[model samples]
Target: MKFEHVILGLLSWRPFSGYELAKHLEVEGRFLKNKVHLSQIYRLLSRMVDSGWVSYQVSVNDGRPDSKIYRLTASGEQVLRDWVTGPYEPSTRFQDPEFMVRFTFGGPLDHDALLRLIRTELECRRAQVARFRTRDRTITDLDPIEGVDTAMVDRVRELSHLHGAASIDAWIDWLQRMLTELGGTVPSTG
Candidate 1:
């Protein structure tokens, strides 16, 4: 989902400045993975205001520069609700760097598509580790330390890949075990 929807959802609760939004996200656990930095939040809010999805009012406090307090417009509310309830549309390609970064950082995302994505990533990583192990064995047999630096680099990469695979495996196992202990699968009703 776009950051705009997240902004709108937060604003739906009440008006807030960019700083306030960042704090809310920290406490509310909505942007755990894509933790919005102060500057990024302000930039997104500025763009949202320009798009008419949100409106802001500049308020000066004490002697500091004016802060823009933002609120979602009626159209923004509608857009947010529609997005929440609308049919899913799989994007051909994701261009957002934050999205990629969040996935890498073990984002606390709990959606069907996210589950599928994690599963796919786990499989890919497992395959990668297998390939690396094979290559490591081959290199070890052929002139063991002929290229010590290159061998060390390969070993490091293999270890990293193995660590990632193990982490994902543990995550999947924990999630499944939790679901089973809960007596069933995750609820379809959001």
Candidate 2:
């Protein structure tokens, strides 16, 4: 996931102090990313400022160092909109965190966008299932190898495929549910 997009999304909600943003990552936003160091957050914030995507004001406290509070600028809003509505290509792995981030931040922004995301995912996962469901698991001993069991290798491969299929099937079902919740019809898997 592009970490900057997450930052832009959060800033769209409201102005957040650097400390508040870090706390958000530690708490509710942890699923998007795990344990972002404070220094890294500040550096990204500085970059955002330089890019004119966000502007910050220093808030001074009595007998303590000042803090930077960040809010999204107009350009930042447009950048975020572009990202939210942008093309999404699924990673090779299923249940990727990027999907969750996009869904969480983009779904509320627009219904059609969410629908598009769900449809794309559903199509891809269904294709994956169709492609992987049946395969030629033929094992050949063309060359003599030491300590290798073709039967064992075949069994392990089957087990791994089964595990992956189960997980992806569950993911598909969940996506279908989400589509229904969004008032969109689920596409036929046939």
Candidate 3:
């Protein structure tokens, strides 16, 4: 997902200046991987305005320079909705920005869509767990060669894989709990 979309999602809730958007992303949205700077925000806002996705008005302050207050346009809202409703590919092996951004703005998504997203993520986490376990086994199964400390090598290698598996397990557990919290059924899948 582009930073443009993130900005649009943030603006979908309310209007904000470039500085304000940057501040919010830096502070409130610090959890997200993609960080937006003030200059980047201003640049994207300009591009969005040109693409008719957003409109802005300059607000003059008593002593400060004029600030451009940006609002998501009707087209922008539609774009955000379309992106949210779009299919999420489950094949990625790493963290997905689409998931992060979509989940962050999930308040606008329908109940069914939200449930589907969580289920899909759960499936992905299950796949990741399997992959990590396989890798861990491969590392542990390596034979010790002459003058090589294979035991230490295996331990070090398994450390990262183990951590990854544990993290995925935690995420899966959280997702399951989320299902119960939402009064949704956990899908019957391995």
Alpha-carbon RMSD of each model:
7.4, 2.5, 3.0
Quote the positional error of residue 120 for candidate 3 in Å.
1.0
Model 2 clashing residue pairs (backbone): none
Q: On residues 76-144, what C-alpha lDDT tens digit does candidate 1 reach at each position? A: 877775655444333322223333322422223234434444344334444444555345333444454
List the candidate 3 regions with Cα displacement exceeding 4 Å: 131-136, 139-150
Instruction: List where candidate 1 sits over 4 angstroms from the true fold.
Output: 22-40, 57-60, 86-154, 177-190
Clash totals in order = 0, 0, 0
Question: Residue 24 lDDT in model 3?
Answer: 90
Q: After the best TM-score superposition of candidate 2, give how far the Cα of residue 152 lies from its true spot, in angstroms.
A: 5.5
Candidate 1, TM-score vs. the true structure? Answer: 0.51
Q: Which candidate would rank higher by lDDT, 1 or 3?
A: 3
For candidate 3, the 10 contiguous residues with the lowest summed lDDT are 132-141
Looking at candidate 2, the ten consecutive residues that score lowest on lDDT are: 135-144
- lDDT score at residue 132, model 2, on the 0-100 scale: 71
